[model samples]
Target: MQKSIAVVFDSAGTLLHMYRVAKDMSSGDLLTGVESTDLVARRKGRALIVLHTEPSVILAVDRNMRVIDFIDGHDIAIDISCASVPFSVEEAYDIIKDSDIRVDDILQVVGVVRKHCPEIFYVAAGIIVDRNDHSVPYVLSTGGRLFHDSKETVDRLKGLGVSVFIASGDSRRNLKQLAECMGISMERVYDIATTREKARIILELKDTYDKVLMVGDGMNDILALRAADVGIVTLQQGDHRPEKLEMSADVVIRDIREVLGIVESL
Candidate 1:
């Protein structure tokens, strides 16, 4: 049967109220008052590799050394995904080729990190790469709670027979937990989606669903938002919405709950 409608959601700023912390590789400074998107936007590289592990796990790995040093010393080639403005997996890997990291080492490091920092909900380790020069300047960790309306919105959409999906540049481990919390199946969640991949998801869903709506709050979502049958941008994250991001959406809403009304109108 052809589904009546499908809604694709962006996780971090759209559905989750994220609290992000970044460690400056060069200065050893921890930045608290910043958004991950903001950090990515300010950097010349505009690319991020998201590590799929709990934040505490990453924090527990060699706390004595700097995050960059630990990443440079180990093998992080496994369970890592990239989000870039216009870069591919091969290009992302090429940038970090000299790090001497591989996936097996990352798995072992995550186990050690998890044993120590069990309180953290999410953790990811990835370098911000400048594609032009192939220089990595930073590593970061992020954790956050779901928005108050996230579950309610998901439940309401499902009740109305609209399929819900999550496509974001986050760790698969974190996205799995989020899927469980929101009653969304794992198959519907697309983790570590780059800008182009998000758009592709929307295009693919159009084949099965009569209508598709993409809801997001950041620059990464621009392509998906543009591709959807009805593109919606939410401002509930309370961050500064870039003009280009807002302009891409068919409708701009303040709260996620407004989606219910939009569905009704459709």
Candidate 2:
């Protein structure tokens, strides 16, 4: 088999669509970033900042110069359950927005906490940088597909004498689980991966492969799509929506069936 590849897509709109844990399919957005993946860390850190706090003194500014208490997580009774991380109270508050913690629930929780405990705040030094630090594990990120026919796709690609790999910005655990469910190898799947790194991987593979195709949805898919020889966008209509993703894509399709054809065309 001649070494040739084409067709890459964004996850959410391109591959599979996933619904949030307890929310409707339309609950979340497609633009999640690095901080979004470290949500557990951000949430635990935020909970810790609220420990032992007086709500009245939490410094916060509303529209029109109103220093209303930060009505989000500034109010959770921060006892000691979440006191391990060395992040600050302010950091916690800001971090909440970046985390994948349910927006409606945690925001309401944080707002309620702020109403009661505003004074007790601690600032943990050391911002959590998104760089590939030694502490960061190997990550895989997807655009938005929860379940996929990746096994057939990868197997076909491999049979065609191609090395196939998966990358996603979704939950690493979730991707691992899905790969298992699909009977695809874990070595091929990547979860909770950053957008930049996804593109970097495509570029790295470009060195070895005669051609590489990266696919995705949303803005994060932009870089990888451009990096590949052919960019593909996938979209779904039942509840999960990705209307605008195909605008920047070279070709848009509904399933993985078209992948090999695109490569053949090239």
Candidate 3:
């Protein structure tokens, strides 16, 4: 019998379900819920969904491993189609690293969020400072990360003899940290990878594997998802509809745990 091989995961959604689940999926509803709360993050409350689209388009860790603000969000957006920065990382990073958004604002929002579901504070805040004037407001960047079963999940797949690979837009240093934390080998990971590269890599493994599966949540993972024998998608929103991804996916889920069930049968 031939062994089955799977080219797995697009990251930030499939394996890592970003935007922790929330009862209220809108900005106004999230803020209002927080305003009614007094406590900080609680495991027994509703989750807070992401307010923005992309996370990496915001602050990037420099070659020095320092978190540096990338583009001017005020000029562009944290959306998938990102653009150039008009300001310097030095000037923009200071404002966000030293935020005045009031603990009350965050506490209220996070509190209300926790009241409905379990939430994780993966990132504090991302902002930018003015270039010409230091005191002026620059922009608010985006964020990402998931509250997940980090180590166990990967081990489960590895035990099944899957040659799992991670190709992400994140830096090599960051991916290495995550892979180590997950007990996966850094030698098996690829960082700063583009969408086409993801697809190409999967096809390259086609000669070895009887079957391959690709799972993702972002638009960037579309091509790679389609290239696989099976594809899965994890995001569902009105504006951020998982349509393109759904078309690419053989399986679709609002949750990530559901994937194990679908993949094991294959």
Off by over 4 Å in 1: 1-3, 26-28, 64-75, 78-85, 88-121
- Give Cα distance to truth, residue 169, candidate 1, Å: 1.1
Better of 1 and 2 by TM-score: 1
Q: Write the per-residue lDDT of candidate 2 for residues 1-266, one digit (tens) a residue.
A: 56655333334434455322111113332222222223323333222221232222332322232111333434433211122233344444444334333323323323433333344121110112122121211111212333356446656766676556667654444456556655557776665445566777778778877888876645556567777777776553233324444565678766766776776675
Model 3 lDDT per residue over 1-85, tens place: 6468775665554454333222221232332212101111122221111123223332232322222222233233221111122
- Evaluated at residue 181, the lDDT of candidate 2 is 51
Question: How far in Å is the alpha carbon of 223 misplaced in model 1?
Answer: 0.5
Model 3 alpha-carbon drift over 4 Å, by segment: 19-142, 236-239
Cα deviation of 3, candidate 3, in Å: 2.3
lDDT of 3: 0.47
Tell me each candidate's RMSD, in Å, in order.
Answer: 4.9, 14.0, 11.0
- Tens-digit lDDT track of model 1 for 139-222: 555556788899999999999999999998887878898899999999999988877889999999999989999999888899
What's the TM-score of every candidate structure? 0.81, 0.51, 0.55
TM-score (C-alpha) between model 2 and the true structure: 0.51
Q: How far off is residue 135 in model 1, in Å? A: 2.1
